[model samples]
Target: MNLAENTLANADFMIEEIKKKLRMATGSALKATKLNDEQYEDLKDIYEMVAGKTQFSISEIEAITTELGRLRKA
Candidate 1:
């Protein structure tokens, strides 16, 4: 595979990982309180953001992961 294809594949994998994490988090939160309309809206927003349907690119997963690392470090 070429560089662009490899990069896209990595991004897709990262997106899937993020979706999995989000699902876990949302599930835990739901166990606490049934997802209200606002909560569902927030989850949808998060899904769009991570899935790159908004102003983000699929490749942005790397940047996001990096930023998360930095936040954890701090």
Candidate 2:
């Protein structure tokens, strides 16, 4: 293959590898987590507010619950 073709193939491989790693990380995070009702409610509220208004990240929701829980105990 030519240099350009080889470079494109390498980029595609890297992209697929990144996507696989992300999927594994997300699945691991979900498997390791257990959210209480309050956290679920908070997540629900967040989901509603940003349902179509913005892009949602699971880690952000996790961070919100973690921060809120810490705040409540302080």
Candidate 3:
């Protein structure tokens, strides 16, 4: 009920909201992309690389996206 407690609670609520929005957006993006099974793991790896400390350039992103386009379902 104190100031710090209230601030932490608000931050937690905001983070949960952010997580929900992120999931929704990501799901929509995946559906739109229509990624194949082979691309699923590649996309997850790319997501982790982007989320983590790895800094990717616009060219790298373009290359990854292009690679995903090349994947076809068996």
User: Model 3 — TM-score against the truth?
Assistant: 0.37
TM-score of each: 0.32, 0.31, 0.37
Off by over 4 Å in 3: 1-37, 53-55, 72-74
Report lDDT (Cα) of residue 42, candidate 2: 45
RMSD of each: 13.5, 15.6, 12.1
lDDT of candidate 1 over 4-74, digit per residue (tens): 23243433344354547544332221221233344334434444466554445555655655543333333
Ranking by lDDT: 3, 1, 2
lDDT of each: 0.41, 0.39, 0.42
| lDDT (tens digit, per residue) of candidate 3 on 1-74 | 23123243433333333335334233222232344444455544544454463445667656655553454232
Error of 3 at 70 (Å): 2.3
Candidate 1 TM-score, true structure as reference: 0.32
Q: What does candidate 2's lDDT look like per residue over 1-74, in tens digits?
A: 23123243433333333335334343223210344445444434433343334443788656544543442343
User: What local lDDT does model 2 show for residue 36?
Assistant: 40
Clashes of 2: 0
TM-score winner between 2 and 3, please give it.
3
The number of clashing residue pairs in each candidate reads 0, 0, 0
- On the 0 to 100 scale, the lDDT of residue 53 in model 1 is 46
